[model samples]
Target: MPLSDHEQRLLEQMERALYAEDPKFASALEGTGLRTRTRRAVYGSAAGFVVGLGLLMGGLFLHQQWVSVGGFVLMLAGAVFGVTAWRRIPRLALVDPRTGAPVAKRRKRGGSLVDRMEQRWQHRQEQQGRGGGF
Candidate 1:
């Protein structure tokens, strides 16, 4: 749903107020988008994984337990990095520079934990009204 004109104006006012209150913080936040950061994280992790693989192979060929352990650790860290980046990918949205508000409309991609819980609560209310019980 789109915001009413009044609501939009109110939001813009709030944004201007926030920016006026802390220009430095607002400027820092304007540096990059979530997608850009996510891409960088994914790329960095992939590079780490490649390096880890090389280390692992070198360690294995030389029969060095310590190097092998280090490689395994690196590989594990890379996998964790990649997974976290992937998880955060869906939450990316474009921000409006002028208002510092998200430009993209929210889509129902099952939503966050709070949204899911709110949905469940509404469903339960409807079921109760219908005299259904668990």
Candidate 2:
């Protein structure tokens, strides 16, 4: 369920209070730690891929089919791991650069194009009424 205006205001106040009271804890709770871990994982995966390449070349030079297959498997595993980790890295842009709080995503309106236009018109009218529309 969507939050009521009062509820949203209350939530915002609570968030601000949390930030004010212990920013370090709040930041830790944020997904930044996960992002960092995923980044490290990506780096590790890249290193693994390089090692796999070296193994593959060594196996070829030694005319070893089993070793060549193992190297190829490692390379495939590393590529998969790196891709997954890269995808898991949270978007930094979604976080507020100033307060380090996550910016709320705008909820998309559920309606037809005409309905959306009408809503936009209403919003513009409200803004003009508030003497801020340009």
Candidate 3:
């Protein structure tokens, strides 16, 4: 279920309290990131997908049975990643020159810096509406 306005407001307040209590912790929480536990599943699977794409293309053009088999194997690998680690990685954009992330941009729409960021994220998420749990 989507959060109610009250829940959203409460979350905002809690975020501010958290930042005030410990800026370091707040900074740590600022960006969505993949946990180390999910890294191999994500990156390894991505590599597999790329491999599969290349192999599938080669198999079609070169009439190579081995390449076709490899492509299917890589597709299976990518599926494993989709089910596990894929959800953990945040959708990220090109890095900002100043802070190496688009989020580092100073301009925002809400009262506090963090609130503005949250608002921006929420807006974009709503606009995209991928229907994912993230």
Candidate 4:
């Protein structure tokens, strides 16, 4: 999954070439991932969670129904924000800064779709061998 330094440099060069050749296209697809923005969103969500926790504790101490309700709302909002940040912030920066292209996420190669299906079928048949019928 890790790219060699030479490959990384090559990819960077290719991307620059592509971008320079057509600024309009490159500009159109520009800025998909802003690190600072992602950081801010994530950090903001964490801060919201801390504040929400405080609100919840205060509401519990006071035993006020309205306070409790408000705290619950705040906690819910914080959780939603935290989830959004955790799920999406990193994904926003899809491109590798060094390569200027989307980084290839590594996944297991089980061969083609049909091959995988056949493998599964073979496995099932083996499991059902002597039994013969479903």
Candidate 5:
């Protein structure tokens, strides 16, 4: 579930405290986010694939099996490189550059079904205690 306003404020306070306490550690933890890294990988892979294609075509025209095999290897390597980079792209904590503090990314997955049910049950109990009707 999305954080309540109160929770968000509390989290911001905690982040500020962390930055104030040890900025060096916070900065060290920060990194270029996944977008930049993925873009670089894409560009590199595209270039490699094109070069490999060219080499393959040249080898076919020249009737050199070894050259064609080398080109195929290059293409395979390029694909592997791209896939590895994509898989390894870390989920970076969004950080404020000026303060060198971590920022919270919104949670993609809400609480599990059981957790949600429990929360609703607790909320109902609280409301009943306050004399609120069903």
Candidate 6:
């Protein structure tokens, strides 16, 4: 689900605070570098696969068994390399830059979705009890 307006504002505020606290760390954790490398890897792998296909066809036409086997191995290697690289790219940076520890490990409360929802509900109740808006 999309974030509510308040949640969006809170997220922006947190991002601003992170940048203010450590601009260098924040930028390093940013995903653009990882994305660029992954993109290059994907493109390179695709090119390799194509070249391997040509080799396979050429070997077949020339009745060269070893060349065909090599081409097949090349194609498999390219696919495996691309897949491993893609999987290695992280979706989120959850580490505390200064501490070098995962954010989840530092939190007192549980980090599961259900636990988070319960915390939110409790927070909402407390706010409402105090005549405050979330």
Off by over 4 Å in 4: 1-33, 90-119, 124-134
**Cα lDDT listed for each candidate:** 0.76, 0.81, 0.67, 0.69, 0.75, 0.76
How big is the RMSD of model 1? 7.6
* Model 5 agreement with the true structure over 1-134: per-residue lDDT tens digits: 97897986787776566667776675566555556778699779878977887789889999998888888888888888888877777654445747564666767555799989999899999999999957
The superposed Cα distance between candidate 3 and the true structure at residue 36, in angstroms, equals 5.7
Shift in Å, residue 59, candidate 3: 3.2
Q: What TM-score do all the candidates reach, one by one?
A: 0.46, 0.52, 0.47, 0.50, 0.47, 0.49
> Which ten residues in a row are the worst by lDDT in model 5?
92-101
User: What are the RMSDs of all candidates, in order?
Assistant: 7.6, 8.8, 13.4, 8.4, 7.9, 11.9
Residue-level lDDT for 129 in candidate 2:
100
Better of 2 and 5 by lDDT: 2
Following a full C-alpha superposition, what root-mean-square deviation does model 2 have from the true structure? 8.8
lDDT of 6 by residue, 18-56 (tens): 766786778686776887899899888878888888788
Which stretch of 10 consecutive residues in model 3 shows the poorest summed lDDT? 92-101
TM-score winner among the candidates? Answer: 2
The Cα RMSD in angstroms, rounded to one decimal, for candidate 5 relative to the true structure is 7.9
lDDT (Cα, tens digit) per residue for candidate 3, span 5-86? 6985677666556666665666566563444546766777888888898898899789998898899888887977756776
> Which has the better TM-score: candidate 2, or candidate 4?
2
Q: Over the stretch 60-126, how does candidate 1's per-residue lDDT look in tens digits?
A: 9999978988998899899899989978874322445456665665555787999999999999999
Clashing pairs in 6: none
104: Cα error in model 1, Å: 14
lDDT of 4: 0.69
Candidate 4 residue 93 C-alpha distance from true site, Å? 6.7
Candidate no. 1 TM-score: 0.46
